[model samples]
Target: MTSAIPRITRRLVALLCLVAAPAAFADIVIGQVAPFTGPQAVTGKAMRAGAKLWLDEVNARGGIRGQKIKYVFRDDAQKPEETVRLVKEMIEQENPAAMIGTVGTSNLEALKQDGVLEKTRVSMFGAVSGATSIITARNMYPVKASYREEVERLFKQLGEMGRTKVGVVYQDDGLGRDALAGAQASAKTYGITLVAQSGYARNTTEVSNAVAEMVKQAPDVIFLAATTAAAIEFTSRYQAAGGRAGLFGMSIIDVQALLTKLGPDRARGFAFSVVLPTDDRQDREVVREYLRLRQNSKDTELSSRSLEGFIAARALTKAIERTASPTAANITETMDRGFETDVGGHRLTFGKGQTPSRYVDFAVLGNGGRLVR
Candidate 1:
């Protein structure tokens, strides 16, 4: 009888070991792809900093379900082809539980087409705003408001001020077309007229001809929808051309960069919608963490891209905690129900039937190139 008892106890121990094996080896991996080098390098640096802050916080909290999260970051250089390559590499190599905080629409669009999210059963969170095409897929979750929303908001404000004639300058791409369509639609609703519209090719720093054409129309306001470098050059030259029309911009343009390039005097009174609050450094923990991270960061200036990255990481952390599993399928399921996180004062939400972020706060360029909410 004693020998029988020892054999029974040994069997029980073996069962316990088998039950604990999966849990012992569990790990959660999250991927981030951004332009670590290129024209948008400043934006990418800020995003990396913001994502690191959130990941550090999550790790300090004992990690998700006792499994530490490994953040695998890759630089896509802001090119769609490079982004696709990097994302494919991450999936093949790291097999991250999910990809979070992809920094551009072009990259997100490519990933969507590649069916990365569907194959991995993971959500792409915190992507930069563009047309609704990216998030139309069930797997892609965007954390920032669309360019369409920005155009609508700007047009609504202009209509309130009784500005009926508007001019638009955009880059010739999917993003630019989205902005132009939104602006045109909004203007039509308000009975405002679109006096002129022009486009420049992507990565073209010179927009003199496009700006000159739009200025020739003499509209009440000129909408500048382009990359930071192009927008800066257009605004500088547009003002130089003695065009007094009020300058408006989409969320893609780095407000700080605009101010830096145009200076406070030239940038004053310029209006744009912000996905996150810049001036509010209140009792928010995220804000405190961001400020701390910024202090140590070589890039001192804050932009919408930085806030987008921080917010995306927060959402990813929430999804991890909610799932409490280190599997991609489980985490993606949690994300479909959506999650909420604070981007400064603004609350960012993502969920079913919600293709893009609806949270947007309006801000104007204040003195000394500051974004005042």
Candidate 2:
């Protein structure tokens, strides 16, 4: 009788609390996996902040069909094994309608191999990779230009700028391999011989040897196929040694963040391929909206990476709004309908015989760390 009386009292308290909770948004949820506590944590934080900014605005507008957007996040630390386990755990337990912000190619590939994507029916949205995973998977979506496109455009852009001798410093991994494939094709097409090429293991700061090799060939533009941090280290050492290569980086390289790390002396005069327009670009209403939202953010500092995250979240939200409920099937169908959507001038449309975005832009860092458009 004593136990029964206490249980009855607990039930009454739960009912009262439920009655008091907000009802306007209490159903929708987004799940994310990222390198929140690793070498990539800086970028992970930026991406999360950007996603939260858009989500907060959406919820303030009463959410999608009055269902509040709740986010569940797990840190993969950019490891493939950990990513596989965590993704499996979420699919079996969390019941998220769609998974967004999963970082790295291996992480996403691990999830697909675990068979959790189909088992849970949780579509992947706005993942960080522009590799083959995006197009090969039935439910995954890409927000940035592919490495292939980035490399090809880099060659064309360099050619346009009258730069023929290109050198590549790439990390030895899937990311680098994909980038190299594209660069080789571009070199063949452009009829330009690669001035020099070298590969280093990921996370290694010992690039003096590679830098020396590249300096001998005197590449007009040094295309970086390495990770962001690795690229910074190489560029820093290379430039300090009086290497005059026009330091070029891929879309995956965060040029702004790289500048912040290297300071004005090392970062100035560097150019990088980007998938999004510059922050100051205001020709598109979508661009203006992003600037406004970013200005209203608490951090006030934004990067191309963060802006891409914002655009991706905003794009997915539009698709979710078309669904009757936050179910994977409904979300997938809505997204596949090929509806024209402008993500701050990064247009995304996919329907019968259509595809997702493949736009590429360019930016160069000038004196005092200013991004010269």
Candidate 3:
């Protein structure tokens, strides 16, 4: 009976260890790659901040399913080759349970060329890029409207505003190609043709030739589809040359960044398509929640990019809430289950093969760099 008591005590201790073992191993690692150290660092910082808004709250509530969400961030310097290298390193070294918030579509193509996603089979959620390939690619998911949807919205708004003679100044890359393709389709639907279209090299603000083309075309509206620096350079030079054309930018262009580049008055009336609603609109459940969260947030930039990241992180948590293991394989399996949760005012759906969200809206940069409906 004394020997039996020791066995019983050992059994009890073993059972206790099993019960308490979860706490020691309760953590989910989420990996992200962006241009954290380059010119695009502002957008990178915004994406990181927006994601943390959701992550911090989830972690504070004992984490989703008792596992704390830990993030591993790497800077790709907005370079495609470097993105491929870092992503491979992340998979082998960091071994993140999931990947989220990649920045550039050029980087996306590079990642695909490297065949990392195919080998790892990890789902990448919510890239800040407007490139259509993110949604069209296998095992990749996007929570925002494609450039086509944003352009569709932009063309409709331009029609309403009685603007015509559309022209395009695009970056000479995959992202600009996507925007240009969408613009052509949207122009057809809007019953017009582009007056002039031009392309400039990526990563350069030298839009002199493009600006000269704009000056020669004298388009009533310019569909600016370049990066922040390129777009700002084109617009600044165009306006300086006394070219008076409506600046209509895609979701990829940072309107706030442009506003800071040009004064508020110069940036005024410049509009862009966005995937999220304005913060002041309480009509939207998502905007309402975003505003409430921003009120308490130390990182409140309130740009569309930030909102996109927050929405993506919220969706990530929704999937993590159900997965028992929360590894890369397990998380990918959760995506297959078809998430139907309504985040903020947005209804997100991700299934085997489907576009996640086509939500797009247009906003004008108002007097104080505010997004006006």
Q: What is the C-alpha RMSD of each candidate to the true structure, in Å?
A: 3.9, 5.1, 2.8
**Alpha-carbon local distance difference test for all models:** 0.75, 0.76, 0.80
Error of 1 at 89 (Å): 0.9
Q: What TM-score, computed on C-alpha atoms, does each candidate reach?
A: 0.87, 0.87, 0.91
Among these predictions, the greatest lDDT belongs to: 3
Candidate 2 achieves a global lDDT of: 0.76
What residue runs in model 3 are displaced by over 4 Å at the alpha carbon? 1-24, 160-162, 300-304
Steric collisions counted per model: 0, 2, 2
Score residue 156 of candidate 2 by CA lDDT.
84
Alpha carbon RMSD to native, model 3: 2.8
The residue ranges of model 2 lying beyond 4 angstroms of the native Cα positions read 1-25, 203-206, 300-302, 336-338, 351-355
Per-residue lDDT of candidate 1, residues 234-338 (tens digit): 888888888888887777777777776778999998887765545365576667766776566565534545766776787777777677565789887886777
Task: Supply the TM-score for candidate 1.
Answer: 0.87
Best by TM-score: 3
lDDT for 87 (candidate 3): 84
Q: What is the per-residue lDDT of model 2 for residues 69-171, given as tens digits with 9 covering 90 to 100?
A: 8878888888878887887777667767788887777677777777777666677777777775555566677676678877888888777777888889887
